[model samples]
Target: MTLPASAPAIVVEGVRKSFKDTDVLRGVDFDVPRGSIFALLGSNGAGKTTLVRILSTLLAADGGKAAVEGFDVGAQPHKVREVISLTGQFAAVDEILTGRENLVLVARLRHLEHPQQAADQLLGRFGLTDAGARKVATYSGGMRRRLDIAMSLVGEPRVIFLDEPTTGLDPEARLEVWDIVRNLASQGTTVLLTTQYLDEAENLADRIAILHGVRIIANGTLAELKRLLPPATVEYVEKQPSLEDIFLTLVGHGESVKDRS
Candidate 1:
């Protein structure tokens, strides 16, 4: 599918940053198409968080430029902030406030007049309606993570920066969060997610970028990246037919038997 000629949702060009004597990003470059899920993958200390910080206008880059939703992150930080919301690795909700209250607070802070209504809507959307009245401190980790994500959506942002959103959740809870993210993208919200989970990227991202040693080492769609590696086939026998055989039977198959293992 072809994208429009309008500016990309995110554009980073030759961006560089460093702390003390350690360079975290060295002339990085990439673009995220509007209304698509872009995943940035890397190991710990690969500068994923630092790049997020710079794009979210929380930190300045030593050099180069980045624009989020058509607003220069450095020159027009306020404009960038207006169109984007961020959820860091850790949940940022206020523990003392009730889940509903926390959402209301963010809505009010964003100057929404009908904060209560907005908060209630988001609560329902995230399946937190029943727990809305409970204090965040009493909520489970999964609930807190959901609330953190909901808070980020309070202002109806067009671009969202999710920094390792599922860091500490269990498999089921992580899947719950992934469903929420998928719904967001379906509604045309541009998502720039940084994660260490390859499976997470494979499941949710429209395109993936792998960062190593403070630079992007690879970038492409899942199938495109997989094409870079050699193909392998597995053979097994079972009395009950295999799911792969059923799927291939239904979808039709090709005869590219590169290997049988």
Candidate 2:
């Protein structure tokens, strides 16, 4: 079914899911606008992954409904799969294959008209052209994760679900992935990101939703969410740079003072 351009890229209404006896999601609701980033923020066991699974058609919702690109997830799973891509918590790359081979494999699986060209283009796009011939097993965590995300783009999916894409990456690598996500949104791809990092959501999401106790406790843009709390009272104090700030500053300029010594 052809949807109007104005339709949301993804929509979920009263979505509920459960295990044998425990409820993972209770009437979750949200919508992702086209060409924007929507972050689902939650701590562990908050049903973020379960929600992504249902939206990506990997699992079924116990009740309610979800539609991706206007195709019903439960009733039109094949259609939903056709327009979406999913990246999970860990890098999903084949260790035996070279970076280029991993991309080529995904392109071939997607049955692209020119898999080699597609793979090469994606390799360059993700800054992996130089490492394309190296075995994935030899790749760094960041490199492997970049390749994994590149593979997810083989078909130019309109909607991408990134479930904790930066979970295990180092700070620098996490920033790299953040740049890639920003680029994707800039290029008209709607991204649904589930992350436990508050900074991640604040930095990337056009709108953020907090999931707690199996329900959406809050949902709004960062500024709007901030409004939910009482305004801060003005105060003067000596400013201090955090350890992370000091670390990143040192790294940005090269070796730390200690390393030089």
Model 1 misplacement above 4 A: 1-6, 233-261
The TM-score measured for candidate 2 stands at: 0.90
lDDT of 1 by residue, 84-127 (tens): 99999999999999999999999999999899999999999999
Residues forming the 10-long window of minimal summed lDDT in candidate 1: 241-250
lDDT by residue (tens digit), candidate 2, 1-261: 666878899999999999999999999988888999999887789899999999999999999999999999999999999999999999999999999999999999999999999999999999999999999999999998899999999999999999999998999999999999999999999999999887888789999888878998778887776555434443454333322222233225333323333
The collision pairs in model 1 are none
Pairs that collide in candidate 2 are none
RMSD of each: 6.9, 8.1
Candidate 2's clash total is 0
Off by over 4 Å in 2: 237-261
- Per TM-score, the best of the predicted structures is 2
Cα TM-score per model: 0.87, 0.90
